[model samples]
Target: MSDLNTSRRTIVKGAAWAVPAISVAAAAPSLAASPEPTPDIDLSTSTPGAAGVVRQTDTQMNISATTFRNTGTVPAEGLVVTFAVDSGQTIEGIQVFGSDIKNVAQGATTSGYGTNTVTLTLAPGTGLGQVTIAPGSEYTSPVGQDILLGQAGAFNLTVTVQASNATANSVGYMPAPQAIPA
Candidate 1:
């Protein structure tokens, strides 16, 4: 009986010391992850702002090829990104940032067939193929002829990016301090 009691006491004392050390070690890695700095990719859509003839409330939006720009740091090999639109909208005409998005190709084909093979498409469930973005570069689509959204949808523009370098280790908009205030 005495031997068992001594063993139990030894285990409890060991745990008391181990618990705090384990906790601190576990917390260290979490402190390292957080708001990874990525370039700001802003999005703009065509919505009839307040300057409307009749304050168009429920009108369809004319999305002329949305653009994804790399205003952040330039990736060495370029960033691989995908662009997508909501279910109610359609994607048409893919082009470079400075160029206008046009579904209709105006150039010759790769096979000497006098046509182009590449195309741009983004629907609710489907996303456009990933494209590389050179540093300080942007990709724009030709004026989407039929991409339309509800009036309310026009008011909000959401941009989601999936990058290995981008981390969500942030509390609020800022990084939490590693050391608690003394």
Candidate 2:
């Protein structure tokens, strides 16, 4: 009887250890699987304003171009680029030029004059069909497309680019410590 009891205890202990080992082995395949590649997008913008200043009367700043480059191993799909401005400032107009872009949407504030953010999205398609930017390729906005600003104060301008398959990247332009004066 004592021998039988000892055999049962040994089996129970061995089973307990085997369960954890089996679980670890089961997880090995998933751990060995490769993760999805992330797309690396770079954003570059031409200088804004003259001497980093925009007159309140003019209320306009012409940015030569805003460029997006894909430096990753994967393609950037369903790309959406958003332009935002600081408080006391408004985004008047932003012309986005891209072959894959479907449309541009601008959001209005309570004042109902100009917007604070402009979003650009890609057309409906897949892979190469709706190519936002392929690896090592780049897209640039058209020249003479003025980025209009409003109000009489200093503000910061930020541009964020996001893709369906990759993380987003942002770049900001604040002319001076006080930012671009309007």
Candidate 3:
């Protein structure tokens, strides 16, 4: 009986000492990455077709009239704008336009599209090469550029704009809400 008591005391003492030793040992560190900073994207609603940007649609095609600007230090890159039209609707073509509004005209309000713009062409599969917007640069509302929605009932499209750089990446939907309407 005395031997059993002695054994338990020895075991407890050994464990208590081992815990402190293990805890004091050095550990590499935690593996969590810091979040990257990003610029803000603002969107507006453009009625169907405007400025030859989008084609006419059967159902009231509610397009985006919003424009985006890089109010941050970093530029937004690798931007791919995506969306889907209903069965009756058709995506005739896609277009991306950019401009230096402040440079094109003077006294232009803080809102509205920019001039000195160029229609960015898309690359097959990858769509267009990365759309890079430097700080102070901006793009049109990116509305359903040249989209033709034939029939209108409840139309939903997953419009995503993915912006990425060598250091960071971000994804977001267009200003307009999405609904996969049939």
Top TM-score model: 2
- Candidates 1 and 2 compared: the better one by lDDT is 2
Best by lDDT: 2
Better of 1 and 3 by lDDT: 3
- Model 3 segments more than 4 A misplaced: 1-62, 69-74, 94-131, 135-138, 142-146, 150-153, 164-168, 174-176, 179-182
lDDT of 3 by residue, 55-170 (tens): 24443334545455555556555344455544345443333233332232222212211211122222212223324566666655444333434444555454544444423333
lDDT string, candidate 1, 26-114, tens digits: 99998896875654432222122231212122443343343554444543121222223333433332333323333233321111111
Q: How much is 160 displaced in model 1, in angstroms?
A: 5.3
Residue 1 in candidate 3 has what lDDT?
68
Q: What is the lDDT of residue 42 in candidate 1?
A: 22
Q: Give the alpha-carbon lDDT of every model.
A: 0.34, 0.52, 0.42
Q: Quote each prediction's TM-score.
A: 0.27, 0.49, 0.42
